[model samples]
Target: MLEKIFKWILTIVGFALGYAATEIAKNWGFINSIIGTSNIYRIGFISIAIILFGIIFYIVSPFIIKLIFKLTGFLESGIQKIPTNDIILSVLGLIIGLLIANLLITPFARFLAGNTILSIVGSTLTLVVNIVFATLGVNITLKKKDDLYNVFTFLRRFSKDKKSKADSKLGISQPKILDTSVIIDGRILDILKTGFLEGPIMIPSFVLEELRHIADSSDNLKRARGRRGLDILNLMQKELMLPIEVVERDFENIQEVDSKLLKLCQIYNGKIITNDFNLNKVAEVQGVPVLNINELANAVKPIVIPGEEMNIHIIKDGKEAGQGVAYLDDGTMIVVEGGRRHVGEVVDVVVTSVLQTAAGRMIFAKLKSAS
Candidate 1:
């Protein structure tokens, strides 16, 4: 039904174009002579032209409809995905652009009054100018929106009282943005529950969308991981103590989630909470602060110095001969020398040395007797 209506509208447009073409053709002396000064012939010429154009448009309407549908779908999704603040800015930009175009076209409009061809040219130029200016307005407005927000935020800090001042001093004027890795790691929830982290935590809409995608994946492990992340997010929002500010911040230009996290950090002047080692390194290089859960876990782990004796089960053999691998309660790997034969049995070992790396802590130990 809509397609038919569109086709009819196109046919009417073609009819109008045919009549306008006739008016323009009158400027050509040859066209006047060929059609004669008779109204009958002139009307006949326009009638044929209108019929031809209307038929042509009717024939091509299906293809045009497809293109229109594609464009509409793309634009609809884009507009829906864009935050409301951005949409308001875009509309303001469009209005400003139209105002500028109206002012600039005023003089040109006068010159185009007496001539149909000139009027058409003037209208086309007006349309082009409107489009160019509107596009420029939108780009400029969106690009400067962050600066504008910062200005407002700065002013707000001055106007609000002591609590606001305290919040600013705490380096949380902007909420800490959570990354997919940290959310999936699930340790952040426990850390938040401890009441150490202050201020509201931000979860981007894109990260949640990514989790949903993962949750819908065919792979069992990925699906489970994604579901777990979602569940953790649910708990944080409903049951956790800290204020959860789930924001819809998104960067359309950035591809990887990690890169988006970095971009978001830059935008909000906020830190990232993540457990991803590579992301942590990248954030450091980018001058973005990061709270790495893995690093935090390692930092809080029980300190074990050399020559410390502890009982550990030799669950497996290490790479070298006569070495058995055990694990601390927190999953720290401990390699025990001369204990490979004791695999599947609990044994005592002395901590020979403790190694720490970006991944976590490792322990190299010798049997208590050998030590």
Candidate 2:
């Protein structure tokens, strides 16, 4: 039914155009003089030409409209994806551009009133003005997109502060990646409760795999540690309800877990949280910043400087002869010179020096002389 209606419309349009062409030719007189040989031939020729042009236009019209609509939809989607703030600014800029074009070109158009040269120059200027406005609109739109993102970020932060979890606001800051050892040790929960650690806690997929491996290990201790790590991870995800993201990005090229963790840190602009001393050293050598739980524990321990006397009970012999080994409250190893005899005995020692490395800090001391 619709197709029939369309065909009727096209036929009417063709006849109307044919009639108009006949009138135009008669008024112009050139076609009339040539075809005055026969009225029927003149009418037939004009009618056929108009009918052919109308049929051609009608056949191609739907496809042309379809292409136009497709292009418009695509452009609309692309424009929508641009930040809202940018869109608003660009639209405003476009309006300003049209106003400026009108103001500057109107006088030229008036001055060129009757001369063909002036008319050509005026038309060219008008085309340039339109092109300039279009180019400025697109440029402004793209440039303001970043500003739109920043505005949304700020609004989100502001809205977050208005709700509950006011004390937990620190979780919204920079992210900190958690490793298997630190999760298993489980001191981070206590640390987080005190509100010292801020930002999102990221657990990489490889770390989860490591925990799973440990959980499945034949060795009882390793299995227990692995299970414990999994439990801590669940607690963080469910109970403590802290912000956590499991980054699934895996390194097919790197096999080592520590290496993958370092790479993850570099990718996320975050620091790795681990307790492995060797891993800590390796991270330092690779220029990846690490937030070693053990290091943090040591830094917070009581500071003992040179000349400070402390009584330590040495339990074993050190690597060197006549040296005894003791430990601080935070598990920092203290090497006492000339104190092998003091093994298993608590004796006052004077701290002589402190040594710090990527692994940890060490204190070197000598037995205090009896006064």
C-alpha local distance difference test of each model: 0.85, 0.78
Q: Work out the TM-score per prediction.
A: 0.57, 0.46
- C-alpha-based local distance difference test score of model 2: 0.78
* Model 2's TM-score against the true structure: 0.46
User: TM-score: which candidate is best?
Assistant: 1
Please, what are the lDDT tens digits per residue for candidate 2 over residues 186-283?
Answer: 99888876778776889899889889999999999999999998988877777565588999878665799888897677556577888888888987
Model 2 residue 64 CA deviation (Å) reads: 28
Give the candidate number with the greatest lDDT.
1
lDDT at residue 198 of model 2 (Cα atoms): 73
Candidate 1 per-residue lDDT over residues 321-348, each given as its tens digit: 8889999898999999888888999888
Q: Give candidate 2's error at residue 72 in angstroms.
A: 26
Over 4 Å off in model 1, which ranges?
Answer: 1-174
RMSD versus native structure for model 2: 11.5
Score residue 334 of candidate 1 by CA lDDT.
94
